[model samples]
Target: MVARKSAFSSEYSWFKGNLHSHSTRSDGKLDPPQVVELYRSNGWDFIAFTEHEFYSYWQELSSDDFLVLPGIEMGLDIPKFGRCHHLLGIHKSGNGAKHLVKAPPAEKDGMAGAQEEIYRLGKEGYLTIYCHPLWSRVEWEDISELRGFTAIEIYNHSSEMENHSGLHLDHWDSFLRRGIKVWGVATDDSHHWMEDYCGGWIMVNAPQLTVADLTEALVAGRFYSSTGPTITDFGLDGDEVYIECSPAKAIHIVTYEPWGRSFYAEPGKSISSAVHRVRGNEIFVRAEVVDSNGKTAWTNPIFLDKKA
Candidate 1:
C-alpha cells in the first residue's frame, strides 16, 4: 500500500471565504458594515478585515451564517531596497488579537524586522500569511529565511487588476523547492469592491463555519485556493494522485523536482477530473487546474516525506 497524504478529508464541508480585505477602518473605499454585507450577501461564509495596522472584532457583522474573523495587515519597509514586507495576522479568536495593532518598532532591521514581527504574531495566536510578493517587490532572498507563515498569497486579485503583480507561482514554488512547507493562498485583498471582490478566495474544508473551526482547518491545510474553479476532491491512493474539479482546460501535477505530469483538454474541450501516477521518489505533489477562461484553482502540496 502506498502512503496516504491528503490536504482535505471526506468528513468536512466546504466553506468559501476571503482571508484579506479592507474597509474605511483602513484605506478602503467602503465602511466595515458595507464590506461585511457585501460578502455575506454574495455567498461568502466568512471574511477577515485586515485593516492596515488596525484590529477589530467586528462582532456585529457576524451572524449564524456568516463569520467575521479578527485580523490585521502589518508592513515594514526594507531599509534601502525600495521593497517592503506585508503580513496578514488572522486570529482564531479575539484573544490577544489586538497585540498586532501596533506596528513593529525596529524598522532599520529590514527583512529581519519583518520576520521578527511574523514570529511575534504567531506567538499571539495569529496565523501569519506573507502577502503579495511581486507587488511588494519581494525577492526570494528577502524572505527565504523567515519562518512560521501558514501560507503565502500565490494570487492577489487586487494586485493583478491594478497591475500584473499577482500570481506569484514562482515565489511559491521557490519555497516548496527549498523544502519549506507553507501553503498557498488566493485572495482578493479587496479594498475597492467594484472589481476586486470575489475574484479570489479559498474553499476550506472545515467541520463548521465558526472561527475556531476555520482557523483549525487553515492550520491543517484543509483547503484549496481558487480564482474561479472549484476542487471537489484531491488525494493520493497507492502511487497515483487524483483530482476531481470543475470543468477545466488542463490539470498539472506539480512536484518538487519537476518530475510530475500535465494533462490538457483537447481544443475547445474541458476536463473535470484527472489523475497522475507519482514517481516514488517525489517528496511532494500538488495540483493546479486551469479553466478555459484562464481561471485557476490550486491544491496544497501533499508532503510525501511527511506522510502520516
Candidate 2:
C-alpha cells in the first residue's frame, strides 16, 4: 500500500475553530447565542456548543460565514482515578428532536460506563474527543484500554486557566507510541468565555465549512492545533520532512526518542521554515513551532514505518 501523507493542500481553505465550549444549557455562564457570538467576533470559522450532557444548538443559530457544529460534553466520575472523564462529542447531526442524551449516573457506572457511553456516541456519528486528561489526572494506563475516540485534547483552555493542569503532550505521545491512530486537538473548552476564549484552537484544511467536510479533514489529520502560531505548510518528501509556519523563534522536530532536532533563530529574528531528515529508529515524529510570544503550533505525529 502507498504511504499516507499529510492531507493539507493548497486547494482547501484553512478554517480556525474551537470544538469544545459550554453554554447556559449546562454549567456554562453564557447562553448558546452568546457563546456563538463570542467566538464569531473573535474570528472563529466554526464553534461547537458542547454543553454538559446536552446537545441542543444544531440548527438554532448560524450564519453564512460561521458554522455551529452539534456537540456535547459527557462526564463521568471514575472511582479508581478519583476524577471525572469528560468526553467531547461533536456529532455530524443533532440528537433527534430532544437534542439531549442523558449520561449514566456517575455514582453507579464509573469508568466502564464512560467507555460504553463513548462507544454509543461514536455509533451515533459523533467525533469523540477525550478531554483534559491532565486536568482530570488521567494516567496513560487509564486510557490504554479505552477505544472509539477520534482525538484527545492536548491543550484545554479552561483547564489551564482554572487549574493549570491542561497541557497533556506526554499522554498524547504515549497513545501514539502504543499504536493508537488518534489525532490531537486544542480547544478553548470555554466556560467563562472571557479569559478562556480564543486561547486554543485547531486550524482545519477543508474544502468547505460543512460538518461533513470538516469532520473528514479532522479524521484524516488535515489540521494542526495552535495556541498562537500558524502552520502554513508541512509535508514529507523522501527522507526529509519540511515545515513552513509563521515567524517563530524555534522549530522543533520531536520523536519517540530521547533526542530530536531543533532549529533556533537569533534574538529579534524569526524563522519561518525548516527541514529535517527522519531517523530510522524513530517510531514517530511531529513538529512544533514556538513564536516569540511563547505561543506554539503542534502538528500531528507521522509514523515513520507506517502511513499516518
Candidate 3:
C-alpha cells in the first residue's frame, strides 16, 4: 500500500468561529442574545456559548448565517493542586442531554474527575478541549496523565488578557511528543471582560455552516486557529510542507522536535507563503504564522506516521 499524505483542497469554504465564550448564564457581562449579536456582527460564522456548567442556548440563538453550538465549560476543583480545572465540551449535536449538561460533583473533582468528565462527554458526542492549562497553573505531570480530550487550548484570549498566561505550546508539544493524538485550538474564551471577543478564532474548512459539518471538520483537523492572520492553505507535498497565508513576517513549521524550520520575511518585506522540507524523523508537524502586527495563527498537527 502507498503511504498516506495530508492535503488541503479548495472544495470547502472557511468558516470563522470562536468556540469558547461565556454569557450572562454564567459569569459573563452580556446575555446570550448580546453575545450572539456581538460575534455575528463581527463576522463570526459560528459561536459556542460555553457557559460555566450550563448548556441552555441551542436552538434559541441559532440562525441561517450564524450557527450556535451548544457547549459547557466544566470546572473541577483539584484538591491536590488547589486550582480549578476547566474543560470545554462542545456537543456534536445542538441538543444536549440533561446529564451531560450538569457539572460533576465536588467529590469527583481533580485529575480523576477531569478524565471522567472528558471521557463521559466524549461518549456523548462532544468535542472536549482542555481549556487554558497555563492559566490554570496546571503542572505538566497532571496534564500528561489526562486522557480522552480531543484538543487543548494553545492560546486563550481571556487568559492572556486577565494574566499573561495564555500561550501553552510547550504543554501541547509534550503531549504530541508522547504519541497522544490531541489537536490544538485557539479560542477567545471571551467573557467580554476586556477586548477578548474577536481576538482569537478558528478558521474551519466545512461544506456548510452547520453544526454537524463544522464538528466533522474540526475532528478531522481541517482548521487553523488565529488571533489575526488567515491561513489560506496548508499541506504537505512529499518531504516538503507548505503554508499559504495572509502577509506575515514569519512562517514556522513546528514539529515534535525542539527546533523546526522557519521562513522569515526580510525587513520591510512581507511574505504570504513559504515551503520547508520536512525532516524524516519528525513525529508530527504543524504551522504557525506571525503577522507584522505580532498576532499569530496556529495549524493543527499532521502526524507523520498516520494517514491524514
Strongest candidate by lDDT: 1
Order of models, best lDDT first: 1, 3, 2
RMSD of each: 2.0, 2.5, 2.4
Measured by TM-score, the strongest candidate is 1
lDDT string, candidate 1, 106-145, tens digits: 4446778888888877887889999999999988888888
What are the clashing pairs of model 2? none
Looking at model 3, residue 75 earns an lDDT score of: 88
Count: clashes, candidate 2: 0
For model 2 the TM-score comes to: 0.92
In order, how many clashes per candidate?
Answer: 0, 0, 0
Is candidate 2 or 3 superior in TM-score? 3
TM-scores for every candidate against the unseen true structure: 0.95, 0.92, 0.93
In Å, residue 105's CA in model 3 sits off its true spot by 2.3
Residue-wise C-alpha lDDT for candidate 3, range 172-263, written one tens digit per residue: 88888877788889999998778877888899988999888998888888888999998988888778788889999999988866557889
What lDDT score is found at residue 176 in candidate 1? 83
Pairs in clash, predicted candidate 3: none
Q: Each model's C-alpha lDDT? A: 0.87, 0.83, 0.83
Q: Judged by lDDT relative to the true structure, which candidate is superior, 2 or 3? A: 3
Name the better of 1 and 3 by lDDT.
1
